[model samples]
Target chain A: MNDLVENVVKGDIRAVARLIRDIDDGIPGVREALKALYPHTGKAYVLGITGSPGVGKSTLVDQMVSHLRRKEKTVGVLAVDPTSPFSGGAILGDRVRMQRHSLDEGVFIRSMATRGHFGGLTQSTRSAIDVLDAMGKDYIIVETVGVGQDEVDVVKSAHTTVIVVIPGMGDDIQAIKAGILEVGDIFVINKADREGSDKTLSDLRLMIDMDQKKYEDGGWKPPIVKAQAVFDKGVEEVLEEVEKHRAYLLETQGEIDFRRSPKRVREELMDLVKNRVIEEVLGKLTETGDFDAAVEAIARGEKDPYSACDELVLPRLEIH
Target chain B: MTGKRRIRIMVAKPGLDGHDRGARIIARAYRDAGYEVVYTGLHQTPEEIVEAAIQEDVDMIGLSSLAGAHNYLFPRTVELLKEKGADDIVVCGGGIIPDEDIPTLKAAGIREIFTPGTPLDVIVKWVADNVEPRGEY
Candidate 1:
């Protein structure tokens, strides 16, 4: 462990931010930093917030962050936005909306761009969450862009997933596909003061009741929270429901450990293996000049890709 | 060894400067130039600006100050970054700075000061040419 890693584990604010920056840039020494800080993590409760773009997810997160802070729990927020594939430019305006916590030392807010990383999060977001966890934040909230099914990946990394829904929007409930519904541990009908709030609330309840498999492993029903986050209405009850869901998850330890954690761990391990295999094989091939020869042969029609891989690639790899 | 990565600049409004029209315009211009820009909202202190710059690991800090407090806020931001071993982060300022104060700000380590009517192309070109990430990526 280096001095910087040690400082990060000790909750040094500057060091924590610098370490996250390095990780985001894919700079060297981050592996060692993660290794040193890993033991200090797993203490923070992670919450995932997802919804449609106009559902005011940012406002809900801001209110939740304030609620957590008032309860004396330190909070860390990761607001993820999608990067423009054509321009590589992103307007990370979530921070502008959450300016209330900008000056609060107990709150740390960061905006991340999904630069080619799928599931509405950057490749560095998980690492940033770990860094925040190690930095001693009691609650870490990951707010996704919440556009499509791919954004559900945020739930895999969280202990609780809050899906925000707005009332009075045409075809609102139809947007909640099966994938999003399965991952939702709690449903929030924000903008509850709107005209069609009752219809949306009843609609969500009927769907949840019909989908029996979502609660098959346990008898816990996902609570429907009615919140007008803009006016700071019913946010406390929403927080209470979140806490209730957390308690339910704690009681169902077998499900969490066997079903959730194992799947997440396997995904992480596979990611590492895939990256390492690419790095090793490509690096060896480049060093030995076989890669170029294979490319040239394929271009010249002298060798097929299958033959090239069998002869040149298979001989060097030790996969079993 | 940045290696042709996107140049990220943090455009921050430090102190009580409520005039953010210039900063917002510059941010949009930089974005149109295909640079990633993180605009820290109004009323940011020097410490908060430095912290955000470090956290975002941006190539440059574009500070906008129109309240005649650049002497203290801008230098304090630079000083905090230096103290945190991030002196490599470029510091630039704009908005309402007088000509006489320009040399003093430069001496205090502001890379460039864009006053009123400074062309957007000049600022964009300066950042693209001068601001480089020090990270070993």
Candidate 2:
């Protein structure tokens, strides 16, 4: 186990892959592995790609990875796919699109299933990113299984977020704007060879313009790039904009970090603390018989949930 | 003891076998049994299967080959995995295999062969009873 963590930190692909599986499986001692890995993380720049299915997001990732690799950058990709609610199976076909890079040693790609995990990325995903980051990957790309406003939690895991959309999807524009507009660091009009590609680009530009507060806030303006990812066209341009976004973040590190990182850290800390506290409280409550009695009382309509929550939580609250 | 580790299995169809009814069924069975299943859609090569197994760090490689290339592709996959230092990944196969060919395949490191009519539960139980993730469990 110690050797596994050591090899993972040394960027051993096999060991890195094994640790990710261990973390995914919730195997014992993986927490220690991640703990050992934690100090070596935060070195890789996390890039998130999100778009509705059929927008060619996977192909875009493939092309972007190639472009990054050409610059001698080592990349790690996490392709998120939805787990079957009934069977827990996932096709994980993202690798099919990116098979051209399968033989490349510098690229490490893993497919993840959402598996009903709430929030942006699954808990496994965060740990997987840590593994990749600790492996010293220069760039980590997370391609969301499905992109929408609801999937904005992905932004929590990414330093720069790329929102992809294709031509001829007029009806999806409004909903996309509402859900992901604020999160996009770069907007890509993939399938630029299509008929409505120009119109789609203009529509995104118009939306960005309309949101003046996003500009007044003085953050970097998101750039819209045209791409035909299948042909590998315009991928480099999109990546250039991504690099610019990264440079902008570094140039204005304090402001961007203050605006984004602290809230993200707080949310992550709260998620951890909340789960641990709930587990402790629930175990104690179950042991003390109050949980079952409360359940029975609630079922019998004798006690309201508001009062019950107080009865359960008041004594546990610590005044700091 | 297995503990509560969720076993991950990759069900792959290699060498142009488009008939995926059996592969999909087994993938679903593993999923329903609470194991994480990574299904490589049809027409994968031996190299692709080995690469997927290594990258995914799967506990087992469930190759479903109906194109009669299992005699060649299945062992080649195991060999490639061994060459890549991932020989510990358990390799199993299911498809149109004649009774006479099973011994040679097993000797070549194909761990188990599930011919037609092999019950899904049987395969699931076999995997549960046989496979564990590499390293100290």
Candidate 3:
């Protein structure tokens, strides 16, 4: 077990892969490994790619990885797909498009299933990113499962979130109403060869113009790049934009700890606390049969849910 | 975090065969059986398949080939896994393999071969009975 931590820190691929699997499986004692790995993280730049299904996210990621490799950067990719809600199973096919890099020693590509997690990513996805970071990857690209109007969780963990959209399919309305649109560090019009490309481009431009005025105090404006990922065109421009965004964040933030900014750290800490409290408290309640009893009381109208919740929780609180 | 561990399998098509209908159906079958399936699209070499399997840390690799290249592709996949010290990953073959080739393939470390008309449930059940999730966790 100790050797697993050491080998992961030493960048052994097999060990790294094993640790990631263990993390995904919720194997016992992984917390210690994560604790050992915590300090080694924050070195890799995390880039998030998210969009609707069949928008060419995987292909674009494949191209971007190749371009980054050409610049001599080691890359780790985590591509997520949805799980079957009924069967508790998943078909993780995102790695299929990125198989070209499977044999590259400097590139590690992993496919993840949402596995009942909402917001386009799973809890294990975050831990897997840390594993890749500790394994010495210079850049980590997290590809969320094809998301919809919301599911903006990617922005919390990514330094640069690139939202990909195709030329048509009424995405203009989607962009207008989506919480996802607000989180893009960059927007991509992939499949730009199709018709209505000009219309889509104009719509996005108008929307950005309207939105940028609010942040016009020397803030970064998200650039829109036209791309045909399958033909390998405009990928270099996308990479260039990613680099520019990185430089912009570092310059504007006035620190090298953009990945560990105060806001992000606070969120991470709170999330850890929330998950632990839920696990411990809920486990105890369920084990003691109090949880079922409370549920039965609520179902029978003997106790309101709010009062039952407080009754169950207030005693457990350490009121200092 | 408290969920049961699920079996992960990679269904890969090695060699130049693009007839992936069999692979696709089997992948869906595995998914419906409540297993996580990573379907590596078409035209993957043995090296690519093995590397992907190890990276994914999957318990099994179901190789599909209709181009009559299973004789070389299946064993080569097993060999590469062995060379990478990942032979603990079970390797199974499907698609158009003849009865005569079964003994040689199994001798070469291919665990089981399911030829045409073999039911998907049988294959899934074989996997459930034969393979456990790999690693100490």
Candidate 4:
């Protein structure tokens, strides 16, 4: 499976997509791929790009990828989409936004959905990142779903987070409610040509200045830059600034993604525990072969879920 | 996309789309009609949606994009969803779709197209009518 996924990591898009599916299904093949790729992880400079919907995040990411490629840096993008609550299906289309990067041999673009992982990247995301890292991608960008607070939770895994905003609409309190301002390492005022760009930019800068440093090491003070991404104006400067920040982090090593250590450990442990428990429970469920009976009882109100849990699950755990 | 219990939907914004008034209203409609809702903030792309759906085992996808790239983004997403072996999953589109473009979308095999200002109840019933749940509520 790792061999298959290794091929995937090395420009085999079809194999890669299959590997992603395997990961989604929690299949054995994905487990092999992940275990094999773990050692090759952590090379890429993880970047988190987030903003309001109309702020042109996709367009900006396109520009950034283009600029990075010009610098000969290999890249991978994890774009998140929204799924309907009524149906757990999603259309992963973030790749369509990066027309140029999609064709680049040095780039890997994977669109992911929240799949309602409780506001975090899926277990497969970490594996996918590992594959991309082993394939030598210098930058890995995770574009999280804009599910308010969960957005922050997802991006916290990245080394640097860029929170993008645009002018106009709503009150100052609303801006704060978005929860982006606090998480941003860099603030982008996209659509700078629009009305009130100056005001938005100024207000953001002031807010940053007013907020106290939460980190003792005087973590990076976010710099706000105004640009219109639609016309490609000011994109170059944004890229340069992004580069500057990347270099700064590299030179300073200001933080080792202070968040990754705990996130990784917790996730690995939980995934292990979850698999063991589910395997035990399912083994019991299947051994009894009372699938139809259980269903009928649950459906007929002969057994509520609470009692079913006690009868079916608790006893299984007790024996284990 | 088949489930016995109602499929829970999560409308996420993967980036900085601050205008989620539409996504939220739609979520409310789905919830009132007996569905679980997982609303990801704003500015989400296709990947986030897929990841959430796989985890939630959703039966359908609904995204609102008035941002002009719907033609490019939406169809590409549908293709990717198919690649995921979720071809049976109904993919729907909404938000500012032009009258003329509706047919093109239908031709693309989108489950249904619901434009802006459509009734929330209609959208709820439409989803219920189109997709089957796999879980027991």
Candidate 5:
């Protein structure tokens, strides 16, 4: 175990990849590996890229990775794709876009499957980010499974989230007006060479202007860049905007702790605790057949659900 | 892990192979078989395929070549995996290959070869029966 941790910390690509796989598979005892890796994290700048499918999130990420690599930064990429609910399988084809960096020792790209998890990312994605961070990646780019409205979980993990959209999304632009639009630190209008780009750009500008009061109050105003990722146009400007956002965060916060604010840390801790407690309690109930009996009793109308809940949980809880 | 561990496979079209219909079909088959398959797209080099397979921590690499470059591409991929000390990742090949070349390819550490018209289930089952997740947790 120590050797595995040591190898990962040493930035051994094989060790890092294996640890991430184990984490994703929910292998027992991998938590010890994560515990060891945690101290080594908080070094990599995490960037989240998300948008609707076919909007060129992967192409944009591929371009950004090339730019970052040219600046001599080591990068780790976790590109996620959705799993098949029916077969519990997935075709992780995002690596197809970023294959140019496959042989580069400085870049490690891992494609992840959502594995039945909602919100555009798998449960293990957070830990996988930590694994790459621990492996000494200068930047870790997490591209979410081409997201729609409400798949905004990437914002929780990224220091700066880049939301990519193409021209002519039509009603899709209105659909994103709710959840995903609010979380972007940077917005990209990729495939800007296509028709209807101006309308999309203007629509986004109008939306940003509508929130002008928030920026007037000295909050960071998200910058939108028009890009043709396939043609490699506007990529540098997008990267520049990302750098500007990072600088703003650093200037405001004094020190950027790899994008995790105190609030995010608190939320992460609470989530972990909640998950652990649920797993333990549910495991115990199912093991003792209490859960099944409660369900059967409820179905038979022998007890109301509220009292049944108290009957099952109230005893388990020690009251003051 | 308490539950069944998911197998990951890289279905790569190495060496300028524009014919990827077979590759895509096999990738879909692998996915349907409950394996997380990374399809690296067309025109990948042997080095790229091996590096991707390792970085993904995949259990196997299903090398698909139809451009008559399998003799070099398949063996090169296998050799690169060995060179990178990732030889534990099982390697297999499919696509246009002569019967005479199969023994040499197998000798070069290609695990199994499936010719054209082989059933998809057969390949999936071969993978399920032969490949376990590589390395200890």
Candidate 6:
């Protein structure tokens, strides 16, 4: 397995990218690669910044990167957007706003699109993060776009989750209460310069207070911070709170453990295993000419998808 | 299919950018082009995306980010993918990419940049030509 990518670290851009390509394609020799780099998986503190559209998550990330650079910590930011099917491209308009941190040696930024995979849930992403960790990035920030309540699901793997909010978005607190509130490690009310900032903060406080009863974890609670991301206001405070949360996790291992329960592990494991099995079975099914027949049957309503999936599909994927 | 290992691809979307039209199209293109495409639904964390790559045993991850969230999502994907020892996967990017960020994207370990107006043949050819699926032996 002496491929060009073995024993490669992440200091350079092309090397890391090539490695990602190889891994993303599910080439055979990747187990050896991860086995070689297993020790570096948990070093980087992962920060997930998410909010409704127009909350200025990017501007906030810019400010955070600036602050991180001041402390001399290497930062890697991952921004995800959508691509055009016709053109196979992205505007990446967000990156255009954060050019200030692009040239900094310690800061690296990249924009990714789902590029027509079922969703942007690519395994290459996991490997990419490891590469950055192995490269010694102290902070890794992933800014995700909100897709209603389900958007919060991605943050489950994050070490720290910052839910960004705008001031005048009418019921910003309500949205938080609806979905993002419970997921927040720390809540950030961005665009604090706007009017109604107090109402938003107060409403958020009230919401947090309501959840106070459900939260039981050595008294761990998500804090709220206000910031005008355009001006980089309170960005440092936000970062500090993120650090505080990370430090809190380190100091209070009991909390992180409880949050990352067995159920969480099982769900992630199932997802991983399910996808892999489906790939193998799907390839076989297609190769054996059952795929199109199954599809046509489903399309023609000759059979139920569940039965088809369980019998023709699941049987093959069964480890037994 | 020849002696080459099938190209494994994890097609993922990182944020609330739920516009899956492009991501879906490319996933099909990759599939039709004879690559194994893994599609994780919208609003995936970078870590989740990376986890999918590792568990699925993929060789390349194609991410489609449309809501201007790529900067935060792509590098995070890169960082996690590398950490997990699947760094040999070529990370190719496609979306409404601005010309200015091309160098930055490349610098962030993007193997190849797929911009708007890129033909499907080009994308199909690029993956077929570049990515080699692991362990065909």
C-alpha lDDT (0 to 100) for residue A30 of candidate 6: 65
Per-residue lDDT of A262-302 in model 4, one digit per residue for the tens?
66568556855665577557766867876556778999988
Q: lDDT tens digits, residues A1-320, model 3?
A: 67898898898888988898878777778888899888888889999998888989999999999999999999999988888998878899999899999999999998888876322244578789899999999999999887753247655688899989888767444654458778888989999999988888887788788876566887778899999999999999998899999898889887545545898778767666766777667767888999999999999999999999998988877644
Quality of candidate 2 docking, DockQ? 0.47
Single out the weakest 10-residue window by summed lDDT for candidate 6 chain A: A114-123
**Distance from true location, Cα of A17 in model 2, Å:** 1.4
lDDT of 3: 0.86
Candidate 2 has an interface RMSD (Å) of: 3.6
- lDDT preference between candidates 2 and 5, better one: 5
How high is the CA lDDT of each candidate model? 0.80, 0.82, 0.86, 0.66, 0.86, 0.69
Q: Mind giving the per-residue lDDT tens digits that candidate 1 earns over A74-152? A: 9999988777777676667677667667668888888777765322143467789889998889999999886575567
What's model 5's lDDT at B85? 90
TM-score of each: 0.84, 0.87, 0.94, 0.61, 0.93, 0.65
**What's the residue-level lDDT of A292 in candidate 3?**
97
Instruction: Candidate 2: list runs displaced more than 4 Å.
Output: A87-89, A117-122, A148-150, A254-264, A282-320, B1-3, B16-22, B117-122
Model 3 clash pairs are none
3 or 4, which is superior by DockQ?
3
Each candidate's DockQ: 0.39, 0.47, 0.69, 0.05, 0.68, 0.05
Provide the clash count, candidate 3. 0
Candidate 5 per-residue C-alpha lDDT over A1-320 given as tens digits, one digit per residue, 9 for 90 to 100: 67888999999888888888887777777888888888899988989998999999899889999999999999999998888999988999998899999989999999998885322243478889999998899999999887753257656788899989988887877888888888988989988888999999899999988999999988989888999999899999998998998999899887778435778888677667665665566667878999899999999989899998888886765634
**CA lDDT for candidate 6:** 0.69
Better of 1 and 2 by TM-score: 2
Give RMSD (Å) of candidate 2 vs. truth. Answer: 3.5
